[model samples]
Target chain A: GIQVEQSPPDLILQEGANSTLRCNFSDSVNNLQWFHQNPWGQLINLFYIPSGTKQNGRLSATTVATERYSLLYISSSQTTDSGVYFCAVLGGTYKYIFGTGTRLKVLA
Target chain B: SQTIHQWPATLVQPVGSPLSLECTVEGTSNPNLYWYRQAAGRGLQLLFYSVGIGQISSEVPQNLSASRPQDRQFILSSKKLLLSDSGFYLCAWSEIAGSREQYFGPGTRLTVT
Candidate 1:
């Protein structure tokens, strides 16, 4: 089984600031995705990057499969961005291993 | 566009009670379905997944079981619930062919007392 670890277990930022979260896996992965869990407990899909970089609005992600790590960037953060961010990876099985998550708090 | 649905947005049950949560996906066929659990203030844990009708895989052993009787419907059931079973359950779906970008349902919060 592959292990997924996320750095900065907790993060707090003022609105309009920027932040980067990291995810490291112990093995090669076929699929990797970023998600933001809102206060209401809904997992919102942010990006699906297996081995490249992609941007969506104020957020972007990059995955280096060979290095077994991924980065998620948040630009111009907002108060609404307060929640937990999770990185999940699917290695050689149908299951997706999730990181411990980065709890983000964007203050007003 | 594909949409995944989960029923009983919230539930509260006593220990040893039976449990069943339903998830259905629309606007797609032969999609892969998955069930995940998230403890209070914790990350998501894969419980089960289905690649197709009647095909299921369990990621971890637990008091829970899943079934995919139909192509787009996945169900999580437990004959006896434990206090530790209280958590938020999420359902997700991904395409079978092109990519594995999983889309999740709103989720169901279960509290076993």
Candidate 2:
């Protein structure tokens, strides 16, 4: 079984600040995605970056498949961005391995 | 354009009680459906997945079972609920299979007492 781990389990950032979250997988992956679990428990897909870099608004993601790691960048953070960020990867099966997650708290 | 829906945004049930959660997808055909559970302060766990009607694959063995009576409908049920079942349940759908981005429903919060 492949293991997925997230770094900086807890994070606190001020409004308008910038932060980076990282996800590391123990094995190679064919599919990778970033998600945001809001306070209401809704998981919203953020990015589906199996490789390369992508930016959406003030948020961006980079997945280095060769390195088996992914990075999520949040710039000009807002209070609404406060939530748990999770990265999931699909290796060889239909099932996805989800990282422990990075809990973020943005202070207004 | 597609949408996923789940019923009973929140639920409180007693032990040994029956439980059923319904999930439906609109505007899509032959989409892959999945059920995931998230414990308090923990990551998401894959419970079950379905590729088509009457076809399901279980990832973790437990008291819970899933059924897909229609191409776009997935149901999670339990004859007897356990306290360990208290968590957030999310229903998701993907266009195809491996590596595709999954779109999730609003989610249902279950508390078994």
Question: Could you estimate the TM-score for every candidate?
Answer: 0.97, 0.97
Write one digit per residue (lDDT tens) for candidate 1, span A20-73.
Answer: 999999998899999999999999989989988999899999999999999999
Interface RMSD to the true structure, each candidate: 0.8, 1.2
lDDT of 2 at A49: 96
Locate the minimum summed-lDDT window of 10 residues in model 1 chain B.
B93-102
A1-108: candidate 2 lDDT, tens digit per residue: 999999889999999999999999999988899999999888899999999999999999999999989999999999999999999998665778899999999999
How would the docking of model 2 be graded? medium
Report how far off residue B11 is in candidate 2 (Å).
Answer: 1.0
What DockQ does every candidate get?
Answer: 0.88, 0.80
Q: For candidate 1, list the clashing residue pairs, or say none.
A: none
Candidate 1 C-alpha lDDT tens digits along B1-113: 78999999999999999999999999999998999999999988889999999999998899999999999999999999999999999999998867778999999999999
